[model samples]
Target: MRAVRDFASGIVHEVNNILGVIIGNAHLAKKSSANAEALEKYMGEVRDAAEEGRELMRHVAVLAGEQSSRARPLSLNDLVINVTSELDPPPELDLSSEEATVQLDVWMAREALAGVVQFMAETKAVTSLRVATRVVGSAAALTIEDDGASPTDDELRALFAPFTKLDGRPKVGLQLTSLADLASRSRGYVTAGPREPHGLRIVLTLPVSDGTPSGDRPGVPLSKKGV
Candidate 1:
């Protein structure tokens, strides 16, 4: 298992490096284009394709169990707020607030946020995504509900199966699984289920570090961390 994980991790790293070069060259090409007509369109596609590939590689790494787990103090409230704002959900979604604070790793928070965002974007059924975060004694919780088409039981079961794309394409389901793994590593867990009436709800619960301050430290970068 460890050998397989290491091999997968190496592949992901190499793929990411290649993607970085592709994106860089594409950006340079875009800038150099004086006409900005035909070349611009092609460059845009290249950029999108490269980004998608990178995301796929990330998911693969998680599925292969190639990533190490790290835990630190984090601000649950702030993380959810930032993620929701970035998603820019439609007005139809209602988001609640919980006046609590807790600690977790920043990387895990970002992965959870990205997973929700990618799921929504791919399904296209979600009109809105809302998040509510709360902190209790020695633990933190985040509840993300999306007003989207509900997945069947089989689909939900397949969610964490590596290389299983919900959209019937080659997609890596690493985001959710990686988040779950990270939570478990931190003495926590994650759950996903149907929301009231309709839609999907994902809840993340993790051990909270006591009175930890959020700051810019030399921890793992979100992109390089894992899928």
Candidate 2:
């Protein structure tokens, strides 16, 4: 077990280093070129692929016992807001929401959310997506929905499996799997399936800690807040 863990860590570190170089060069290329439209598009694809590689490494690292032990009070609302802001999805990507609150480890939630965001951003099939959060009873729910193509049965099954990428090599990576694992470790679970007429929806359910605030906790302010 120890050897396996060490090997996984090594792999993750090596991949991260490679990805860093790719992203750096891509940025430099984008900045130096006069007619950068084509170059930027190509570099965007490359950067996305490298990000997938890094995400896979992170997932393996988690399985290799690279998670922290400390648990701090986390605000899910804040985490979601931050991720959406950083991604800066187009205005069409509706970010509707309801009041949701929870207390969890800030680092864990951030990492898990980051993984999810990265997965969506890297997936080519997914064109427009929206993320919403709600608080019900003693739990918090986060729903990420996309109007992209629906996943086949095989793709759905492989969604949560480690290193399982989708067709066209666009969906292959460790982001979703890692995020699922992170949720599980935090006493939460994630589910993904077809939504409405077309597209897919992923819901993450997490238990709310006792004594946590009911209204907007500290940190970032989301789009909508409710009790």
lDDT for predicted candidate 1 compared with the true structure: 0.61
lDDT of each: 0.61, 0.65
Give the Å shift of residue 222 in candidate 2.
14
Note the residue pairs that clash in candidate 2.
74-104, 100-135, 165-172
Could you tell me which 10 consecutive residues in candidate 2 have the lowest summed lDDT?
218-227
**Model 2, 97: alpha-carbon shift in Å?**
7.2
Q: What are the TM-scores, per candidate, against the unseen true structure?
A: 0.63, 0.64
User: What is the per-residue lDDT of model 1 for residues 49-68, given as tens digits with 9 covering 90 to 100?
Assistant: 68767766665555556344
Candidate 2 residue spans exceeding 4 A from truth: 1-59, 66-68, 90-99, 213-227
Q: Give per-residue CA lDDT, model 2, range 1-227, as digits (tens).
A: 75456446656665776677787767767775776676777577677768757655555666556444755555566567666666755313333264455655555566667677666666666667777777777778888887666777898876776555465435444567667877777788999887777677788998876645433343454333111
Q: TM-score for model 1?
A: 0.63
